[model samples]
Target: MLTPQQPLGSGFGAATTTDEVMTGIDLSGKTAIVTGGYSGLGRETARVLRAAGARVIVPARDLSRAREALAGMDVEIAPMDLLDPTSIDAFAASFLESTPALHILVNSAAIMAVPELTRDARGYEYQFATNHLGHFQLTTRLLPTLRNANGARVVSVSSIGHRYSPVFLDDPHFEHRQYIPLAGYGQSKTANILFAVALDQREKAHGVRAFSLHPGAIADTGLGKYIPLEHRVAAGVIDEQGKPVRDPARQLKTIGQGAATQVWCATSQQLNSLGGVYCENVDVAPVMKEQPEKIDMADAMRLTGVVPYAIDPASADDLWELSERLLNW
Candidate 1:
């Protein structure tokens, strides 16, 4: 059965840090793959997991930059560009050849609202292509390795930005409708959630479960580098001085805090029996059935729960089919 979108009262909150959430957990002998794990919350997560004795592999587009950022850490770096389908396939094939099992897969890489419309080789929007489609292909390719692990968890690092818009199924590539940056981003994020829901339904009986989560509004993660300073300030993520505002209550978070939920979902014993749920604040989030009336970014940030449409099972199945068709798989 699908897990309900209700908080588990895990006693962890928005202020929980990666170290805190990982307390008393030992990941020794386990293996994990974290995409975009060179920087931002992804990097922090990789660091924490490696410290906990998991063999962490980070796939990066820029090997030099990844090595520099990951220096002094024991984590391994592999070359793979999310935008390139062939690169993803190559990476998956190489990983499966060397690794017998993958205990955890964290789809932590993503791009935020790009000011301009960008498309991949397939002509899909950049945000959707990178954040959703790329991970979708990677996970499907790595399914054998994941299933090999007796129990494995797939964590999707989605965002509250999903509230900005549901997936534009009718015109996902924005061919018919005018493209808006945030809407494109929102569409991808919603896909992240729906992908988890659908994946869990199919994989849970095989001991592989999936989850999606909001990492809160972390301005230092570089995911928002494409968004302008004024817009961030307006969104209350940063101040006029260009410094990140730390307010866990309002969803703004430090890097450690922002990385907590994904880590929790990946390692928490409490979640062993649960999957296909949307989580925030280091706990399963409740469903917000009513969509707010065209709220601005600031207001959207204050919104606390997952939107109903993002977790709809029927939508999840539809998205899975659409993703397969798009990837030509």
Candidate 2:
């Protein structure tokens, strides 16, 4: 049975840091792959997991930059571009040749709200292609290694931005409809959650559970680079001085706090039997049945629940099939 989309009273809250959630947990012999591990929340997560004794591999599109950013950290860096399918396949093949098992897979890398419509080589919308489809391809290719662990966790880092829109099954690539950056981002994020639901349902029996989560609005992550400064200030993510506002209660968080939930989802013993749940604030978020009305950033921050469409089982299955068809896998 699926875990209910509701909090389990996990003592941790929005302000919890990665170190706080990982206090007693040990990943000594575990192997983890954290995409986008060189920066932002992903970098913090990689640092903590490595400190916990896990062998963390950070796949980067830019090897030199990744090495520099990860300087002093005992983590491996490999090349893989999410926008390129060939690179993904090569990266997976290379990892499988050396690693016998993968205990944790955190799909934490993503581009948010690109200012204009962009597409991948496959001619698919860039945000959807890189964020959802690319990870979809990578994860599916790594299934054997994940299952070889006997027990593993795949954490998909989604966002509250999913509330902007569900997957557009009819025209996910914006081929027929007008392109809207947030909506495109929203569809990809929604796909991330639904992918977790579908993947967990299929892999839980094999001891490979999946999860998705919102890491809060972290301004420093560089995920919002495309959004204009004025818009960001309006969204309350940053102040006039261009500094991140720290308000855990409003879901605005520091790097450590923002990295907490995905790290928790990846390593917390509290989630041993739980999977396919959309989480926030370091716990399973309640499901909101209806799409919320248009609200400002402050109001949106106060709303932390996952929408039903994003976690619906049927929609998950549908997305799985659609993704498979699109990837031709």
Per-prediction TM-score: 0.99, 0.98
Show model 2 residue runs off by greater than 4 Å: none
Q: Candidate 1 overall Cα lDDT vs. reference?
A: 0.94
lDDT of 2 by residue, 85-153 (tens): 899999999999999999999999999998889988789999999999999999999999999999899
Predicted candidate 1 versus true structure: per-residue lDDT over 133-172, tens digit per residue: 9999999999999999989999999999898889988789
Residues forming the 10-long window of minimal summed lDDT in candidate 2 = 289-298
Report the number of clashing residue pairs per model. 0, 0
Q: Which ten residues in a row have the lowest lDDT in candidate 1?
A: 288-297
- What are the clashing pairs of model 2? none
